[model samples]
Target: MKESLYKRIARELAQQISTGTYPPGSLFPTEMELCEIWQVSRHTMREALRELTEQGLISRRKGAGTRVCEPPTSGVNHPLSHLEDLLLLAKNNLRVIKKIDEIVADIELSQLIDCPPGSRWLHIASIREDAQNPDAPICWTDSYASTDYARLRTFIRDDPHSLISDLIETHYGIKSHEVHQTITAVGVPKKIAKILNVEPDSPGMRIVRRYRDRDGKVFETTISIHPAGRYTCSIVLKSQNSGE
Candidate 1:
């Protein structure tokens, strides 16, 4: 497996743009200049530049030379560094428990949580509010955990700041080895809309997280719904070569 010369050039240029070497609105080298510098033909240089243009990294015109554009960043506010950060989000907020019930997952619930239809679970429903601004709710969350830890219900009600997964680990001595998450754009349901004080079918973000134990068995599933502009998720990525 070998890398093509044009693609390699495109990657190098992209790195420069990302690293602010060629900042936004700055002029980029001309095709002839790049061809001469890289010792490549006009076609190869054109292809490389075209790749960057298509990625919205740069713009070019006949008379106006190519210029870098502002790099796009995901609308993020809080940067989650590790599992503790994830738990901190729940611990820092105030969760007002709406209801707790024992149930068997039906067909729809099974698909949503990625669990068997006949699985028994303890469902805890709550609304998270900012500690300082309790008047404005943040999101609605539904957490389903294995009924084996039903004793956790009392503790959950008493401790509104602790996450169920954390509680499970504390009481049952079972730790989460990994967590799988999925985020989707959805409309706020009618029931949730009223509670959140938003319009029905309004824009919302649906986030589902599955917590697994060391045995790779899913022990808990949580679904959270946040109104548009209410929450922003962020993550930092690094390259292996950059020893930081």
Candidate 2:
């Protein structure tokens, strides 16, 4: 079947973005201009732009025309509606390590990471930042890795884009069968607030992700705190019988 006109236009716009023809933060052509260029109706152009917005590729505002934006990991707009978007988050941000230490999980730590109290863990503190804007950190993260993967510290220090669970799978053959995630609204702690360039006790979102192996063992857990206004999470819901 032939692709719909709006879908074709959306694909063309995405390609233009990927090729840097329309760079991030650059203003996209107005709806009228786009309609004229493609010789399509206003409704067709609107749908085309809507498709790009849903893909996290552009932002639209009443006074702001349309603006090309970076993928979710850059914090312009984060769409958690699909697995691919989660992978994109890991691919786009670079995690810069600040410190690493081996310690036994105490009661508080165990509850925080959802691990056993007595289990040994390698605590890795890092700050993730957008590759394009490294000076302004995106979030402060605390990662806890199973002691079995202690060598991950060295590898993680050397590489920034690779997730620890992925590295564990690559080096130790421990595949991640599932991931448990939780999101909470919290305040930015004073200790890491300065690093994240946010004030202490400011509104923030704390995201906790735990990667579990086939046997349901948690191998890696990361808690990330993103300041408000720096991140926006968009969830898309589809109808079960939307085929019609």
lDDT of each: 0.80, 0.80
lDDT of 1 by residue, 1-67 (tens): 1247886687677767755789888999999999999999999999889767765679998788898
Residues 1-244, candidate 2: write the lDDT tens digits. 1247787687677767855899989999999999999999999999889878887789999986889986554454556653334544555677888999998889998998887789888888998786566766778888898788878878887778877777788788988777788999999999999998878999999999888887998888989899887777677887889785
Which regions of candidate 1 are displaced past 4 Å? 1-76, 241-244
Clashing pairs in 1: none
lDDT of 2: 0.80
Assess candidate 2 and give its TM-score to the true structure.
Answer: 0.71
Give the TM-scores of the predictions, in the order they appear.
Answer: 0.67, 0.71
